[model samples]
Target: MADFNYAFISLVLLLPLALLIFLYLIVRPRSVNIPLKNRHVFITGGSSGIGLALAHQAASEGARVSILARSLKKLEEAKDAVRLSTGIDVAVFAADVRDYDAISKAVDEAGPIDVLVVNQGVFVPQELAEQDMDEVKFMLDVNLLGAFHMIKAALPTMKNRVDRRPASIALMSSQAGQVGVYGYTAYSASKFGLRGLAEALQQEVIGDNIHISLIFPPDTDTPGLVEEEKRRPELTNIIAAGGGRMKAELVAKKALNGIKSGSFIIPCNFEGALLSVATAGLSPQRSFLMAFLEVVTAGIIRIVGLCFQWVWYDSIQKWHAQKKRT
Candidate 1:
């Protein structure tokens, strides 16, 4: 009996070890380190919030940074802030991401970009029944289509860059992108669209040594979040309350680090990391260890995800019951 127990324990230990070794050998698009130093890092929506923070972090890392936004004044302000903090002057461009012609002109003038950060996004949280069509269109245009416009404009130059080093295109997606949330109908759709774009774009750009990173930051303490909170539905706020907020600078630091490491899914906080693993799907993973963890934890993570759904639905049911009582 003792000998049988020992053999069963050995098998349990050996199974995981074998699995880890197998995963390390088969992971595709193998790990790469994309150097940021002396590279041109171009960011959109860099006038404020996470975009401005990314500009600062990139400049500090010795990259030639350029910021673009609709307001030239805010862009100038962001440039000055980076200069003050890092003593590095960043180029500023004024253009709306929704305008392909203007954004394309800006990209052409900025020259070949080694790193393109598509950080522009806008969100208005409301249930589909209550949300206006115009508001829905606005979110889709700026958050989803804007990303398309920026990438379409920069792809040619990025593909032909003289540096010939590994380039990066990082998209700023929200936790809402991973799972649908109450009252985030239009907003979530826009963010979710980014995942599809990143997945397909990676396949197209891999030959050019261009890597794609989809950054998933939970509720960040940015101006945009502040504005979003004011308009967020009660149920939306309740559903999102479980996820903690992160500072813009902290999120930017995490994002930049993930970009440098060629991480396809960059999660800012602990909760964001959990969301990434739970929604790994068929996304490219460079880290074999992470891939192993995803495989091992898939079943338990699904249960945890279901538990979260239960909690969220419970909150919704309670809120409706209270409304009926009132």
Candidate 2:
């Protein structure tokens, strides 16, 4: 019994070391670097907001940038904006993502895409019972199905890149995608679908050296956001209060950095970082260190996540009770 106790200490110490080595060598994520310079980067919804900002950033980084949107005028404005900001004249393509044929033709005209950013989304925040079915369909068609169209059109050439360098496909999700919120039912469903798409697509394309990045940005200050705010429910305003808004430029910068590094999950702020850890799930990791962190902290982060859920539930209950009294 004395010998066993003495040896137990050494065994415990050796176990962690052995596990770490296993994680580092056998279970570590595969490292990939998806370069942006001189490569073609196609961004949807690039005429405004996050997409436009990403276009400007990519052009500044010497990528052959292309902006796609439903509005010709907006695309032209985006082109001029990029030219003025970065001295790079980006190609402009007008196509609605809901129209797969138009997206296909646009992809053909754009030549080959080394990086594709599916950044277009629309949100009309209201409770499910009060929301129009058309609005719900619009969100799904644009936010979720649109991503499918863009990737389907771009993948063949992206997979066959002669340069043999890594390529990236990024989907612009929302923080709401990670967790359901007060008034984001339609939008959340659409964005949450992207996580599943990104995960499965990564498995499908990893052999071709194509990587996927799912970017989750909180409330971003943009023209669309102003419109959304006017229609936002009071309960939603209270529920979404603390996340704070990120400027489009900052969000774009974080997104571009994540794309370049081939990050599978790109969280855009401090709260987002916590959400990322808490909801990491089965998302692929390409960084060994991040994989280790996920493994080590999964349990604790889940507990934290549950605490957050409790707070959210409490808020919902209080809001409902207050309404009853009124």
Candidate 3:
């Protein structure tokens, strides 16, 4: 009986060990390190907030940085800020991401980009019933289509970059992209669209040594978030409060580190990391250890995800009940 029990315990341990070995072998694309130093890192929406912070981080890391935005004044200010902080002068381009022609022109002028950070985004928080169609379209245009415009413009040059090193395209997606949130229907849709873009684009660009990173940052303390909070629905605020928020600088640092490491899914916080694993799906994973963790934790994470949903729905129901009482 004791021998049988020992064998059972051994089998249990071996099962996971075997699974880990299997996952390590099957993980595709393999591990890679995309260095940022001496590379040209181009960022959009770099006039302020996370974009500006990314510009500063990239420049400080020894990369030649370039910032683009609609306002030349803000772009100049961002450039000066980077220079003051890092003593590295970053190129500034004035253009709107929604305008393909303008973005294409800016990309051409910026030359071959080693790292293209599609950081431009706009959000208006309102329920689908109350949201303006124009605002919905605006979010889709700037957050989703704008990414298409920037990527389409930069791909050719990025593919032909003289450096021939591993290039990166990092998309700034929100935690809302991972899961639908109340009063963020349009905004979430736009951010969700980025995941599809990143997944498919990775397949297309892998041959060119271009890696894709989808950065998922929870509510970040940025100017955009400040504005968004002012207009956020009470229910939306209540539901979103659980994810917490990170400073723009901290988020940027996390994003840049993820880009440099060629990580496919860059989660800025512990919650974001759990979301990434829960939503791993068929996304390419380079790190075998992460793959193992994803596989092992899948069931538990799903239960946790369901628990979160329960709480969110409970909050919604109570909120409505309170409204009825009032």
lDDT of each residue in 140-188, candidate 3, tens digit only = 9999999999999999989987778899999999999989999989889
Ten residues in a row with the worst lDDT in model 3? 236-245
lDDT of 2 by residue, 274-321 (tens): 888888887877676677777778899999888877887888899889
Write candidate 1's Cα lDDT for 1-326 as tens digits.
Answer: 99999999999999999998998999888899999999999999998999999999999999999999999989888888889999999999999999999999999999999999999999889889988999999999999999999999999989998878899999999999999989889888999999999999999999999999999888888889899898899998887877678899999999999999999999999998898999999999989999999999999999999999999999999999999999
The alpha-carbon deviation from the true structure for residue 269 of candidate 2, after best TM-score superposition, in angstroms, is: 1.3
* Superposed model 1: Cα runs more than 4 Å off: none
Better of 1 and 3 by lDDT: 1
Instruction: List lDDT for all candidates, in order.
Output: 0.93, 0.90, 0.92
The TM-score between candidate 2 and the true structure equals 0.94
Model 3 residue runs over 4 Å out of place are none
